[model samples]
Target chain A: MRDLLRILSRFWRASLAAELEYRVNFVFSTLNAALGLVLGLFALSLFFQNGHAFDGWSFDASLVVYGLFTTFSGISSVLFVPNLSRVVEHVDKGTMDFVLLKPVDSQLFVSTRNFSPWGLPDIALGLGVIGYAARRLDVDPGHVPAALLAALLSLIILYSLWFALASTSIWFVKVYNATEVLRGLLDAGRLPIAAYPAGYRVFFTYVVPVAFLTSVPADVLRGADATSWLAIEVVVAVLAFGLSRAFWRLSLRSYTSASS
Target chain B: MTFLRRARAFLEVYYAYMLVYRSELLLWALAMSLPFISMGAWIKAADTGAFPLAPVEFGRYFLVVYLVRQLTVVWVVWEFEYDIVQGRLSPRLLQPADPVWHYVGGHVAERAARLPFTVVIVAFFFMLYPEAWFVPSWTETVACLALSLLAWVLRFVLQYAFAMAAFWTEKASSIEGLWQIGFLFLSGVVAPLAVFPEAVREVVLYTPFPYLIDVPVRALLGAPITLRDVLIPGAWLLVALVAQRLAWRAGLARYSSMGA
Candidate 1:
């Protein structure tokens, strides 16, 4: 664990240095993030224009969900997506051998090898939205712990889901489109799961579990009784992580060293 | 070779290239259907009389938006950004053909390759909501198809122009990202323009954004097609083509001066 921490720190430093070389990226990403938040707010206002509530979600409540979705998007883009996209490139170019030969866990190294510091603006913007929404809703301080716990579990589930998808590149070598599929699912997370039909809600909650990534956390923040949902999220996260790790091992076993 | 023969060869090459990435094309078609996400919320809101659109109308509108989006979406910004940053445009410049056609050809071919998948998805939606499906009059159908082609051309030129910023900065993709936020809301991807606040709708109707997706969708949904609808998009297409030409010339000059 100590070695892994050191490696991650070193990798992060390198990534930060590389990213800082292009300072304009920070400005552009900040602008893009702000524009995205504005659009989200616009969409929310449009939805609430005719009524006070949508499918039992007040405007402020839906904003909370949108905030959670934005935060998740930031986290994924900053950490998971950049790294997983590399997995596809490495597999395609037979550079996976170098990754495996590294003096650390291959999965760990591969998953944490890079980061996009520009994505920080997205995180900041998302937190700002969440704060504004929470204030508007007058969320109770008592709900903070559950909300934090649900948010953590949601992150875990999302990372596991991305890892599983990235691992498929070892066999398919061109499953990069998996991220696009995930993006589509994440777009759905901008609204409460209950807003969808019964069939879509079932598919999102159990099959893809995008509902758990944002809606459950938002529900907890709204002081809703989401304890059971949080429990399910935790269970799903653990199972997904274990299954993905096993799949990674199986994929690695089939990976022939390209250098040879 | 003559221009038509060269164009034919480019189309064939890109068509085969697209076929090789059929899975990615299918995934892209699926991803572009994100209108469904907002459709769910609007439908639910309509059910409670919170929105003006009937639930069935929301279904039909979003379904048409989904299909039109798949048909018209352009990804040239990413491609041009890559070529500029990696100096790949130098080789293409040496060829007899203009590189813009390479991107245009690839996009058109990819859309053709995605036809089967688009049909499958549309059929599935039709199966699920047979009552929501509507076939427009022959004139409306023909006009919608023509408008969609114009929309695609305008989008392609606009994105290619935007991507030319890569010659000046490494963050060109950020411009595309920012444009997408505006396109998402103003183009009626989130909801029909008719449902927007009357003042906002009036303003949006004058912009090029609505011509990109909303006009074609409205026409396909049996809304009255107007001469103004065709004229506005035609004007925008001419503007985009001029901008694209100017940007391309400036970008090539920069590329040459920089010895790249």
Candidate 2:
């Protein structure tokens, strides 16, 4: 694990150096991300127009979910997109064979070999929003650990879903854009899970598991008892990660390289 | 006669290619299901809140939103960026027709291929949420189709205009992504404009974003629309056309596509 961390750091540093050459792009990306966040918040505000709130959710509490969604989107951009987009290219060009022959774990190497600072603004803004909400709500600092734990579990579930879908590219190169479907669905996370109807609730929780990514974490942050959903979330994170790993290995078995 | 024949040729070849890529197109169609997801939230809101529209009306609004998105979605910027980066544009530039025609042809063809998938998804959605079922009058149907066509053209022109940024920056799609942020909020995808505050709705009407997604949606919902609604997007279409012309001239002068 230490060696993996060392190699991952080296890879990220190399890409970061390359990306830093575009200072103007970084600035534009930051401005764009900020604008996006503002507009997103504005969209959320619309639902709260006339002081109406979803059942059991105030606008302030919804902001926590919005923040988590934005943060996870940032995490996706930083890691999932940069890597998964390349997985298509690597497989398309038969470079995956070369990657597989390497000494280290191919999945870890591919997943972390590139880092994008473009999503940095999004992460910062998301954290800023989360902090802003915590301040406004005046929550006791005692709940901080619960929030952190929920955040970590949600992130794992998200990354696992992304990797699991992206790994299918080994057998179906055209499935790269399948993530776009996942992304469109993830927009549901921008709202509180309670805002959705019963059918949507069931689908979002069991089918896509979007609730675990946003609402569960936000629920914990809002001083709610985690007892109702925490165990399920833990099971989901473990099951999702395990599924992604098994799927990747299963896909690799079917991969046929052009260069070979 | 020659122009008609050439256009047909382009469309035919692209149509064949799109048929081969029908599976990929299915995923792309599924990606536009954000409206359905948002519909669930809005419909749920109507059940509890005192809002402008009823639950069934909100369902129809977002169902139409899904259709508008499917009909008007554009990816020319991504294709153009890839062509520029890979120097594939050079060979296309050597062709008699402008490269934009090829992209336009592909988009039109892909829409044809994607229609069945869109139908399937909507059918499934209706099965699940039968409250959303409704049929517009013939006049509304005809007017909505015409408005949707205009929306598609406006979006395509706008995206193609942004694609010119690839000559100046290799990643023009990210620039186009900024436009999506605007679209996500102002285009009435998240909520119907009727739900917005009177002041905000008045202001948002003037932006080009609403014409791309909202006008056609409202038209299909049998909402009262004036001649100005059509005129505004028509004006933006003219503006984008001229802008794209200028951008094409300037960008071509700067373009250095691999030994050109």
Docking class of 2: medium
CA deviation > 4 Å runs, candidate 1: B257-260
Indicate the residue-level lDDT of B148 in model 1. 92
Q: What tens digits encode model 2's per-residue C-alpha lDDT throughout B75-168?
A: 8999999989999999998889888889989999888988898888889978987877888999999989999999999999999999998889
List model 1 lDDT by residue over A49-112, tens digit each.
7554656688789888888888888999899998998899999999998888777889898899
Where model 2 places Cα greater than 4 Å from the true spot, the runs are none
TM-score, candidate number 2: 0.97
Against the native chain B, each candidate's TM-score is 0.94, 0.97
True contacts kept of each: 0.69, 0.73
Q: For model 2, how big is the iRMS in angstroms?
A: 1.2
